[model samples]
Target: DARVTQTPRHKVTEMGQEVTMRCQPILGHNTVFWYRQTMMQGLELLAYFRNRAPLDDSGMPKDRFSAEMPDATLATLKIQPSEPRDSAVYFCASGLVRSAQREETQYFGPGTRLLVL
Candidate 1:
């Protein structure tokens, strides 16, 4: 079975610290996405990449957060000067984008749980 995998499933850090999370997408998938879940915003797509190239990251704070795909298998999300409001679960999902379809199903990883004190 194809599945997405993430490292450091849980993270706890003091406010203003830097937090980094990594994900390994399922092999053969060409699209990857990063999402943040909070009670106020619910689930928001922070970034997305197609064929290992970043396509959008408008949902994230440009000064404090960054998302990148180092390679075909690896995707990373980093938050510098992390704040209390940034504490939330970050999810990485992967799937194939079909030109014929308007929507495609994505398989999500277990997610990285982060807490900023």
Candidate 2:
């Protein structure tokens, strides 16, 4: 039984605290995706990677958001100096899609819910 797992399902932090979210995608999956869901952004994709190589992260706020894969079994998303506007649900998903040229469905984790004051 394989599944995506996320840590800190809920978090509350001050206006300038650093927050880190973790994700464990299903085994054998080679692509990972990060998305942020907010009232204003709806479901906007933040970043994407294939085989640990970033494919596109144009949707992410480059100033404070960073995403990476330390290994095949681990992926992380970090936010520094989190702002109130950053309050939202962050999700990590993994898939077999190697590129946009292929249409592999992504499976989402439970998501990390963050609130900034």
Candidate 3:
């Protein structure tokens, strides 16, 4: 079984900085999701894609957070002008939806760690 891979597992940055994280989904997976974990917001869904088409991103912080798919196996998340509250563990998940309304199992990458000082 293939697995999702992420780079720069840990990052430390100053306030109002830019952070970029990368993820490689499973080879056959067509859906990718980006999420941010925080004690206050809990698990916040940032964005997701189905067949490389963005399905929803209402939970994302529009001013600073952005997600994109440069290819089938690659997904990237960027945070510009990061704040102290932006420090969290960002996770990338990939899966295939067997049905339009239902989602298949998502395999998670180890995640990229970000810290703002």
Candidate 4:
């Protein structure tokens, strides 16, 4: 069975610290997505990659956050000088891209919950 995995399921960090979240996408999945959720924003797509290449990250703060796929199976998100406002649950999802005529469903991993004090 295909399943997405995330590490360091929970984290607590001081303001200005760096936080890193990792994910392992299901094998053979060509699309990977990173998302952030908070009470204010509900859920937002921070970034997504297709075929291991980043396609969009405009939703994320450019100077403080980054998302990348180092290989087919691994994806990572990092925040430098993390602030209390950045504390939220981050999720990684994987899906198989289908043609325009078909629909694709993404499977999300159990999110990494972060708390910045």
Candidate 5:
């Protein structure tokens, strides 16, 4: 299908629990960005992916957070042993690249809201 459908929605969980987030992609788009928002830091970029490959995830805590794209239409972010500081509204945004133009602006997903105690 050419339309985006059945993307993963929000989530809520307690502290120390594991959280897994998935994004059902839009057709033809090759890039995804994971972001999280909180009162202190506002919006922060947690991961960036392109062409079904993870290019950078420096913003996420290596010990707890992981981002991966197992295929072209699926992207995932996992947090193990989530902490209180990890509580935030996590969002997945996607975009398509055009050769003649700058990168298009990404649109956010339903957002997974995590409350880690």
Candidate 6:
């Protein structure tokens, strides 16, 4: 199965220590991203319909869904710890949204099944 393997393989790490998470894009596709609904940053009017800048997670609840765009070519989504809230990726769609292009129809992928405890 397609997956991402984070380095260190540890539950936690010391401050200043470098950590890396890696994943590969599906064949013939260039985007490998997801959206999460946390109690913090839940859907804010779907402001981010797609994983563009700020990786729109407006579809999320009001917990803590953190998203960032370190640069123009990379998008990152950070999952926060929640007791009663499940941080798993419920809906994952494919396709690209490049500049000056029409938005294409996206197909949903199966749930990541990532249950954080």
lDDT of candidate 2 over 21-110, digit per residue (tens): 999988999899999998876899999888988999999899999999999889899999799999999999998865556677899999
The count of backbone overlaps in candidate 4 is: 0
User: For model 1, how does the per-residue alpha-carbon lDDT over 1-117 read when each residue is reduced to its tens digit?
Assistant: 879999899999999999999999999899999999988989999999999888998898999999989999999999999999999999999999888988889999999999999
Indicate which candidate wins on TM-score: 4
Off by over 4 Å in 6: 1-33, 36-52, 90-94, 98-103, 107-111
TM-score of 5: 0.88
**What are the models' TM-scores?**
0.95, 0.93, 0.93, 0.95, 0.88, 0.42
Q: What is candidate 5's lDDT per residue for 4-73, written digit by digit as tens?
A: 3323455667888988888866768888889998999999999989898888888988999998989888
Tens digits of lDDT, candidate 6, 1-117: 543322222224333332232222233443445544445765223223233444445554445454444543343444454433443333343456676777665544443333444
All models: lDDT?
0.94, 0.91, 0.90, 0.94, 0.81, 0.40
lDDT of 3 at 55: 95
Model 1 is weakest, by summed lDDT over 10 consecutive residues, at: 96-105
RMSD of each: 1.0, 1.9, 1.5, 1.1, 2.1, 7.4
Q: Could you give the candidate ranking by TM-score, starting with the highest?
A: 4, 1, 2, 3, 5, 6
Candidate 4 lDDT, tens digit per residue, 1-117? 779999889999999999999999999899999999999999999999999999999999999999989999899999998999998999999999967747888999999999999
Candidate 3 stretches with Cα past 4 Å from truth are: none
lDDT tens digits, residues 1-117, model 3?
Answer: 689999889999999989999999999888999999878887788999988888999989999999999999789999999999999999999988776567478899998889999
Q: How many backbone clashes does candidate 3 have?
A: 0
lDDT of 4 at 17: 97
Per-model tally of clashing residue pairs: 0, 0, 0, 0, 0, 13
